[model samples]
Target: MNAYTLLPFIVLIAAMFLMTRSAKKKQQQAANMRNEMQPGSGVRTIGGMYATVKEVNEDTVLLDAGPGVDLLFAKNAIGAVLTDEEYNRIVHGIEHDLKSDAGLVPDDASSLTESDESDGSAAATADDKIDLGKKDSAEHGADAIQAAEDKAAAAEAKAEDESKKTDGDSDAK
Candidate 1:
């Protein structure tokens, strides 16, 4: 066999080895995490159910889903072991000592919009601008509905005229 043919096989074997190695490492980590689960520890199952670990057996776990709700789950079914803060925030709706959001970035692009001082020229000519199918709002709500109805009526009338013209042309032909 040529070296070129062996190269592909070598690459395939290397890839499979690396993938299996990582998968084994992940399994080991999961096993360690599952073994570390103690009573009162918060856990999320593979099915996305959040609960508190009430008991840890050899291959099974007793989870306290809620008050008077004990659910038995396999150790492999536990997806994540959550921190107290995360568990409390999700389950009990308790917020930890969070810093003020003033320093954080805004969630939307509203802050990026041009301010009045940046572009007042557009605002000055806004009233004189022709409509470009922009919906009216606030005080123009009724006017917007009326405009929409008028526009639809005009479209229907135009379609009727076109149909009439087409029929007349057909007769001529």
Candidate 2:
């Protein structure tokens, strides 16, 4: 009824408007991320299930869920990139051979895979510096894999040296 009373109402309305605007911005960001997604990228859905993108169309994606099964979902339904366990599970369950089935693999798959793989190989070759252990390999594991191989080789050489030393001690005794 008075100006002071109207002031509180106006403030409340402004706060609600700001909150909605923030939500819309976040939604737009997520949509943009999904639109840019290509095949071979790991994705999680709004329902929390993770899948590897088998194909991407204008408004939908064909996701491999395993056991010869694939799921078709709207582009906007994807929540985010999947973690290591999720990607492995999805890949392991795929019944159709992605490499063999030319139709199954999306056109973008090769380029995306090549780009991601090249980046990884380049990074690995550039540095034996990083540990690249299990934790560092959540998204893609190729770099971590090379690191693991190096670690294993180092361990084996150490073990062999220890065995030879023990053999020499026994012979001397």
Candidate 3:
């Protein structure tokens, strides 16, 4: 076989090798992080709960979920060990989104009720009518078609009378 015939197999082997290498690197990092866990450290669980590490066992961890509440979790369940600043920012909401909150619009519908005036009368006085933007015609033009229908009916009646007169005279001619 030509060299090109083996190119696809080589590419497949290289891709699999790279993927496994990266996965092993991540596993090593996670193991190192888990082994370095100590009491009083902040940790996020795989379940997304943030807590302080109360105790670190060989195969398990004790997390302080809240005041007077400690929960036991597997070592693998600890997703990440956060820094003191990031932990306080996330768990206690300290220094979190304060600047963004100043310019943010309210989540509730209370802002929609406000208008130019502050006495609560501006909303009602703004526009009482819902205008369709159509001007009224002097003559509505609806009767334009009605008049044609009436004229057609009148001509039909006259033609029926003319047919009665023509029937008797046609045989005589």
Candidate 4:
């Protein structure tokens, strides 16, 4: 085959090789992080359990999940070594403002009363802003549940009537 015919095949092979190499590099980095695990380091496991490293061994690591709660995990189950900042944030329940421009209500707005006015629109309360979407969804869910109950009751009543009719007919015979 001519070079023109083999060009696409070569490009595909090159892309695959690059992807494999990148994945291997990432795996090596994760392995390095696991190897660097030491006592007192905050680590999150692959199972999403956050714990402090109490002890490290060749094949297993003891983790302190909480007060009076220590568990053992395989060395390879360690997902990430948490930084001091991350660990502190998790422990203190601190949230980072990742989406400041997402048009979310501020924490202060949660305490607003119905009489509170904003942007010269007294009709728009905090409840109106938050409950507009949820109200429709909740109403629809309740309607569906009620309809289902009504259908089930109708079916049960029909079955009972059929049974009574059958019993009357058997007695006549």
Q: What is candidate 1's TM-score against the reference?
A: 0.57
Which regions of candidate 1 fall more than 4 Å away from where they truly are?
A: 101-173
Q: Per-residue error at 160 for model 4, in Å? A: 50
Model 4 per-residue lDDT tens digits across residues 144-166: 88889999999999999987775
Better model by TM-score: candidate 1 vs candidate 2:
1
> TM-score per candidate, in order?
0.57, 0.46, 0.55, 0.54
lDDT of 2 by residue, 74-162 (tens): 88789997654556656566444456666554656434434455458755555556575546556668878888999999999999998
Compared with the true structure, all predictions reach lDDT values of 0.89, 0.79, 0.89, 0.84
Ranking by TM-score: 1, 3, 4, 2
Give the per-residue Cα lDDT of candidate 3 at 32: 99
Candidate 3, 11-68: lDDT as tens digits: 9999999999999999999999999999999999999999999999989999999999
The positional error of residue 84 in candidate 1, measured at the CA in angstroms, is 0.3
**Given candidate 1, what's the lDDT at residue 86?**
92
**In model 4, which regions exceed 4 Å deviation?**
94-173
Better of 1 and 4 by lDDT: 1
Per-candidate count of clashing residue pairs (backbone under 3 Å): 0, 2, 0, 0
RMSD after Cα superposition, model 3: 11.4
